[model samples]
Target: MLNVKSKLQTCLLYFYFLGGTLIIEFNNDEILFLEGETGVVGIIKVAYENKMLFIATQNNEEIVQFLEKDDLIAVSNFKKDKRAIRSQAYLTREENSPLVILNKEHPSTKRLETVLSVGDRVCLNCNITPGTHPEQDVLCSCDSLSGLEISKTETGIKLNQYFDKYTIEKF
Candidate 1:
């Protein structure tokens, strides 16, 4: 009995070291990804593909891909169309739209919110303001968020919070 228990413990430890951490749980229509968004809430997956991430909620799914590792400042979801579009049909439609903001605190939930808020323009890459007192660069509307100066990249907006620096692709 002692040997059996020891072997079991060893096996479990081995799996943990091997990254067999599929710490995903599902409840009804909700799926939770552990250690998600700033350790606040778990991440719910709406869709995924090779080299891509798609998160969703009740309405839409935001699609994004990996760029450079360092350029990635944080990943959050906002319940709004961060992009502006010129469409007469959309302008004529009157609806109450609520914005959901995702941060590190609740990564999973925020990711799901972002997925559901997918549109033509979604904020992906972020950066630190870099000064005596630094702040986060806002999610830009530009196609890519990589460059030396924040203004040069696109979307001159800056966020008021710090973001997660983990690379999803590294996982």
Candidate 2:
């Protein structure tokens, strides 16, 4: 059963890359990267004609091979639709990890918004109660936690308790 689910996910992933429409699953703390931004600077180079599109990142500077039919279509569609590129906003993770894009309307994002409104800490990776913190009570038996706290900045909504990879998803 697990194998079947994995295969299905793989098929969906392939279709998402090759099909006319794209479907993205939403996760909490995601930010949209629109066209013309430095973060999206090199996306067009790789997203051109039926070329194999790899997961693109802001730091990738490798030049891609020549384009194909699909590459032209991808560029044409992108210009025609004016769609924004979406990527996850990770509270904690390695700097070099590939960006994760998600849907803005996904249930998980909505649920996290609700959770934050009530003043609770959730694991950025698991969306469960944070492990433990000095200022916040331990809401679960999660053993790796350090802390979680609300953010005071205008640019962000929340703050992580620790700098480790297993960070708290503040807002």
Candidate 3:
């Protein structure tokens, strides 16, 4: 019995070690992609407790991906998407999460290009509730060399710099 218990403990420890110890921190508005994907898969919207909410684009439709901390890591020989984890829980929750389509092209692509070109930093802080048309959202101001603050609401997107606010109707 003692030998059996010892073996079980050793196995558990081995699995734990194999799981991975590297922890990743995600900031709001940060883009995440799968291992070999070039297009934007999702953007970090909120990080709470041990979970994160992503404004993800799937098949050109907007959806939400709620993932736990362990989801980001690889545990077995199975191939895993880098930032997009495919855990059992993730699969279970997929059916309940509804997909919302953005009428126009998402602004992230253009904004990212502009930011990369001018060397400006853009970040977002949002609060979203699943299954709501326009979830309660708050995008805090960004501090960058250019002092540009950009935020996206359901119907409109806003950009504010030095007290001048620019609002685009949509997209």
Candidate 4:
């Protein structure tokens, strides 16, 4: 049997167990570079060692490579449709790391709404008591903006206030 965790650590690849040869999917779920905030459809592919992802459009051919987990934004799997629901959320893991899901449109959002504030430091805790719901269990803390608005983007969590100036530390 292949060591799934070991392979993931080295390549940040996701194995979709397809019976024979493992089908490794490159997690290119987010498109970081777009013109004027327009959304772009990310290319998806299955790759193996020595074989990279390739695509051919009507007039262009492109070959792309994958990056390590640390070099990319964490992946997420939302259970609901974000477009229709307005606040759909899902959890996903990259490179065998702790799973993180967006925390929008959840009933628990009301619970966390009171705790978050502007300037207050927030940490995402994956392993809390009762691991029944990973999304609800994760925690965020901050010192200011007691009623901070929670939003989701291609990257990750988006606070209503500007977080560019503050240094965010994740555990």
Candidate 5:
């Protein structure tokens, strides 16, 4: 079964084509650098929230080939229209390793309006969870974690005022 799956994956490499933007998913765990792909396809980030996997292709030039994002492509999104580009707001993932989707009956899975700040930068590909630290809880999405750094504290989730990869200060 594993061999068949791997073979099938190798056959098809296309992942997402949202609003004219192409988001490629690597069939293999390791990324293959094709021509023009040396600096185009950024790292792939996966966040487990609400028992669903949220995937995003980052364009940040810092960690392109040097540090690639981990793979989360074995699973699929559950939504019919899973094209989560700038137009879309949410996406769901299969019950995979990093995430296990909750039933509709679950209160935590309920979708709600996300409050955004004036200059807050969020990943349009992933679902947004407002006012919470994603790493601290499984029911939260890392959409708001695009260019910001977050840390969990006894009081609450702390975020950096500015988008600094190295340092995170009080917001």
Candidate 6:
């Protein structure tokens, strides 16, 4: 019994080591941390072929700022086309996360190009629950130079209408 338990522990430790370490704050200010573990909420799915970073935000029915595998981040305002693949936003990163669209001629393309860049967390039209914990609904990374993050909980948002921009403030 002792041998089996030791072996199990070793395997678990190995798996944990294989991942990475992350500190996440959940709802009610609940904090969780794991060493050598990555992707707790598993927001960004990186396939072997093409990898993309995705994250939804508070009151945002869809993804907020989606950084493509190539380092281009797309910003969307949840109006018109709500999905990150649709709405128009430039992150304001280099005048754009270059804007994600396979078809350059799409109507939203031009809007994305003209949209502004964000220096801080751009919380567009957020209706966070009164008691909602900051860490629960959202998946974010502070280490990122560009302040884009994802939300797991369903944040209330007005569909197809671009709201005013909020500044991404750094503490």
lDDT by residue (tens digit), candidate 6, 1-171? 011111212111111111332112122111111111111111111111233223333344334443332221213222222233122221222223332222323454334321212221222222322112222222122121122242222211111221112211111
| Candidate 4 residue runs with Cα over 4 Å from true position | 1-93, 98-133, 136-138, 155-157, 162-164, 167-171
Candidate 1 global lDDT: 0.22
Window of ten residues with lowest summed lDDT in model 5:
33-42
Candidate with top TM-score is 4
| TM-score of every prediction relative to native | 0.19, 0.18, 0.18, 0.21, 0.19, 0.17
Regions more than 4 Å wrong, model 3: 1-22, 37-40, 47-171
Off by over 4 Å in 5: 1-68, 71-78, 85-131, 136-171
> Candidates 2 and 6: which is better by lDDT?
6
Candidates' lDDT values, in order?
0.22, 0.21, 0.24, 0.24, 0.24, 0.22
Per-structure clash totals for the candidates: 15, 8, 0, 13, 1, 23
Model 2: per-residue Cα lDDT over 27-65, one tens digit each: 223221112211110011122234332233224433233
lDDT of 3 by residue, 8-127 (tens): 121111101113221122323232221111221122222233343333333454545454322221101012322232232233233333323222245532232101100011322212
Model 4 TM-score, 2 decimals: 0.21
- Rate residue 142 of model 1 by lDDT: 20
State how far residue 155 of model 3 sits from its true place (Å). Answer: 28
Residue 95, model 2, lDDT = 25
Q: List model 4 lDDT by residue over 1-171, tens digit each.
A: 433322223234333333332232233342211001111111111112232222222234332433222222211112211221111111112122232222345455443321111111122322332112232212332223223333332223334433222111111
Pairs clashing in candidate 5? 51-100
Better of 3 and 5 by TM-score: 5
For model 3, the run of ten residues with the poorest summed lDDT: 112-121
